[model samples]
Target: MYIHFIAIGGSAMHNLALALHNKDYKITGSDDAVYEPSRTRLLQKGLLPKEMGWFPEKITANLDAVILGMHAREDNPELQKATELNIPVYSYPEFLYEQSKEKTRVVIGGSHGKTTITSMVLHVLKYHQKEVDYMVGAQLEGFDTMVHLTKENDFIVLEGDEYLSSPIDRRPKFHLYKPNIALLSGIAWDHINVFPTYENYVDQFRIFIDSIVKGGILVYNEEDLQLKKLVSETTNTIRKHPYQTPEFRVEDEKTLLQTPEGDMPVSVFGSHNLQNLAGAKWICQHMGIDEEDFYEAISSFKGASKRLERIAETSKAIVFKDFAHSPSKVMATTKAVKHQYPKKQIVACLELHTYSSLNAEFLREYQGALNAADTAVVYFSPEAIQNKKLAPVAEEQIFNAFDRKDLQVYTNPEDFQKLLEQQHYEDVVLLLMSSGTYGGLDFNKIAEWIK
Candidate 1:
């Protein structure tokens, strides 16, 4: 197979490129600017472009397919050249569907917890030596690439995102998968730039549920009233199974899960994580993993990267970095951390990154999200806002939005750094939540301080 990628340096696109390259497909890709990890990985794979810009001359009639990434615009030069040559173009998700159409597609979708749920399922399956093709949003410990593809695997597990597939393709990426087995963790309105309204953002999940194949299986989080209501009311003729957070308790700072055999100690904790584990167990069962095997494997599951990941820990203090930017997610993470360490007074810091979190209108949704923490701080880069071409968010707007008078807000990285350096770390847990690094804060320095 001969494939060309436009905007190939994206996190997802680069992973897919490496997967296809490993499959012995002739792959070529172009990206104007590629960051670390993606740049290093692609270069190591010999798939990195020699020069960084789109070259229409690279597109040829011999190419079998052109995979378009979300980073590429409709007017991208290489995209135009491919279109002019009448080459078949496929959005990233569209191409994934084309490749896995013959296999039983298992898609995990929702606004929050999808990545962790997908990682948990993969971890259990791998523990049982069950090798199946998979694509997850975050990097798992055992997986080399975020995406894995094979011709022999009968099933393909995918982290189904509700985000747009490509600049030119307005549909949600998950809609293209048309899964035979699907899981919806929960829904929280996001991507305000595109969806514009909460109602419109929710309709995407409704459409996702409708996209499941006839007689397929649908697993949902029953505890999420919004998701439960949708699942109970859906007319789709698919088998349904609902799951909630299982019985668990924290003892001596260890998360223990109650099983038929006995109490099972797990590496990961938090109510939200426990809920994610429950959802993963249901999906694994559908994929032929028994409950006993699921619990056994899940006992060692650390967690997906940046999903409440412990960066540094000591007898006195611990630090967690989480990829939480949405209002619901922020609240869930803050509450979870507090629940796990009830005796300690924790300091929580959130970085308002992502387009949705920066939107002036969307700020109100985050009201009281960080209330669970003993000390809550919010930071956002004005430069980032300007780079996104968004309206400048005022300090007054931020205060009114969070409704927390004591909320310490910083508008630049220097102030955030000073805040981190000046903090005393004894007897307190630090929770840092953001989709992007807090303006390139040296995490190692924070780890040293916490230690």
Candidate 2:
């Protein structure tokens, strides 16, 4: 089938384009701008648009469908033309659903841990020689692409995001899947710009739960009180399976799982990940994987990229980078590093990068989020705040928000780097938490300098 992608340079959109290309479907895509990795990958596949930006002339009726990305605005010329020509336009999630309608869809959703849980399930399934169409948000160790779709797979694993589907489609992406099986890792208020209130944000998850097929299964994280309450209150006919953090011990900086066979060593650590593992186990079991096989395969899983990933290590120092920006995620990631290396000094540095993180009102929600770190530093750029059209966030506001008298704050990237360079590296765990680069700092160079 022939498909044209509108604003296809998006991380998820590019992956889907590559997946369709690999599936022998005729794929063409156009974007106003394409950045690294997406640009390189698209060029490699010869799927890169000959010219950038949308063109109304490209929206021909002969195209089977036009896949829309969130990057495209509502008034995009191509999208307008597609509508004028009466050609079908599908949001990326909608297109994915169309492709997997015949397959058993397993969707993992939450405010966080969705990517990790989905990656774990995919890793275990791949290890067992199971064939499945899948889409994960992050780049995993062995996966060629973040998305893989095929005609022969009987099942599909989707990393369900709770964010809006597209500019034209106001529904959450997860709600479009209508999964046969679903998992909720946990919930924390996010996307404050979109949802505005905690209750409004939670209503999205409720809608997602309601979208599950009749008699389908929902595996959830019982440790999350809010999520637990939601699942308990749901009267849907779907089966409910709840899980918590599994029994595990940290030994010599490594986390080991207590199993009947023996103590198995796992590459990923922390209570959040352990909780994610338990949820993945339930999904895998429902997919026909035995408990023993799940345990064995998970023991070898090295974690999804940038979710508590160890970027550099030495005899006396270890540096970790994570995509943690929300208050709950910041707290969990900080606690995880501290718990694993109790004897070492913890220096947790976080960048206020997201729209939610930069908001003064939202700042109050981060109270005590970084308490676990021995030394905590928060950094934000005034330039970024202005660029996003957000109110200026004072360093004093951040200092008070964390409720840690000792918290250090920086509005200048240079000062942040200098402070980082001056820190003592002896027996220390350096945790860098952000959804963005801390103002374009080269992590590898910094790691080498620290070493």
TM-score of 1: 0.99
Give stretches of model 2 more than 4 Å off.
none
Model 1 misplaced stretches (Cα beyond 4 Å): none
Q: Considering summed lDDT, which 10 consecutive residues are worst modelled in model 1?
A: 442-451
Residue 261, model 1: lDDT of 92
lDDT of 2 by residue, 324-377 (tens): 999999999999999999999999999999999999999999999999999999
Q: For candidate 1, lDDT tens digit of each residue in 1-451?
A: 9999999999999999999999999999999999989999999989999999999999999999999999999999999999999999999999999999899999999999999999999999999999999999998997999999999999999999999999889999999999999999998899999999878998898899999999999999988888898887789999999999999999887889988999999988888889999999999999999999999899989999998999998888999999999999999999988988999888999999999999998999999999999999999989999999999999889999999999999887888888888788778999999988889898889877766
